[model samples]
Target: METDIVGVSEHRFDGGLLAATRRFEAAADVTREVGAGSVGVAHTLIALARMPGGVAAGLFARQGIPPDVLAAGLPGGGAGQASDAGAPRLGRLPVTAGLRAAFDAAAATARVDERVLLIALLARLEAGAVDLLAGYGRVDLDAWLTEVKAGRRVGDVFGPDGAIDPAAFGPGASRVLAVTVTEAGALGHERYGIALLLHALATTPGGLLEQAYLFLRRDVRALREQTLTLAGSRPRAGRGPAPERAPVPDEPVRQVL
Candidate 1:
């Protein structure tokens, strides 16, 4: 519950948390522009839905979000005009107690497993979080929130089994890390957040989640190339192509009668 110098509660600003914070700020800007005069979950979802076709947007589309709905929800002023030149408008968008609690919980859960950051965002229903999730077909939002409230172990939001080891980020997750760094670099940011992770999941080297995207885009070659690239980078352990299997010493062809 300790607030940082900026007056917001302290949380892990390393990876996805940083990203979510930035998006929250942007959401507040949108709220201001739309004359809502306060930041809330509705603004956050609308901001996320406007990711311009990346893993972030794909996250929503997978849940059957219609483009028209997003269009209807977008804040109407000139989008993407928020700049870093002046001091941040943080004073205008005060972080509520609910949001601070969510941040604290996300930080604690993320310590065990960073991937569950999304779940933290979903756990709190205030600010249109549940409504946004329902838009993405989260029929079990109540159950999920309950589990989070009960202090369940952090794991994949969509996984059916027990908790997965957070340290064991899959191939897709590694790609997400790389892409996130790349995105932060592009933005001249020293750190990254969930937005970049979402973008990465929507684009290059997506694991299972990309299946739907590939089906829609029909870009199998890119996926194949990505797989090959990861496979190729693996250590051979002093093994060299299995010695080409010695060409199997072809037997002389028997003359067919």
Candidate 2:
């Protein structure tokens, strides 16, 4: 992909997930605040650290570099630093080549999300940013990235513990489930089952499950085959009236967000 200079709002992502878009917006804000000529990976990292309620912020917190401390160490702020009152405000600055390359790297993933973007940004961090981050603490970049890729399942929706937790299903997961249920109904199944769930996951383009498969270097076809075999072995509950046949939708389930 060509790494052309592009406006932050105009940059495109593979999945077009809202979280990814918001992160870029935050990076743009950071770039403007620092009066940089263009947005860079460093600016995005700073944005991720300062932005609350995201995976990056949580990771930074784990590394003992909370938002306030990170901000204090940056150029604009900290003890004994001159105020940035006269900082120039540039309009619609384009993203730097390194930043664009980071986005391109993240886009190469099965699904682009905050976790993937953060890893890409960190991988492409400039030496100055690395030094700046090193001042905060001993930041093991590799270990931090491993944690990002191995996402937390504290309240995973797919698990039994989080099955009944309303908060577990975010917009993305909710869309996947909605498609799964619709496909199940179309198949004349009285209740949702593992096979249908797996089918939905394999078919849903740009979903989290697909991303996992890619990250693990596994094939989606293998998952589908396993699901089918498992379903075939399970005996049906007590005989019930046969469900009426319905045509499956021609188009695969797609997540719009």
List TM-score per model, in order.
Answer: 0.40, 0.49
For candidate 1, the lDDT comes to: 0.43
Model 2 C-alpha lDDT per residue in residues 1-257, reported as the tens digit of each score: 43322322323443423553453566667666665656667777777666444566666766777654544455532111112333211235556666766767876776565677788987887665666677556788777778677765543423342122222333344455666655555445545555666776776776757778998998877876676455332334533444453322221211111
Off by over 4 Å in 2: 1-23, 75-91, 153-257
State the lDDT at 115 in candidate 1.
32
The lDDT per prediction is 0.43, 0.55
* 10 residues in a row with least lDDT, candidate 1: 248-257
RMSD of 2: 11.6
RMSD (Cα, Å) for all candidates, in order, is: 16.5, 11.6
Lowest lDDT block of 10, candidate 2:
248-257
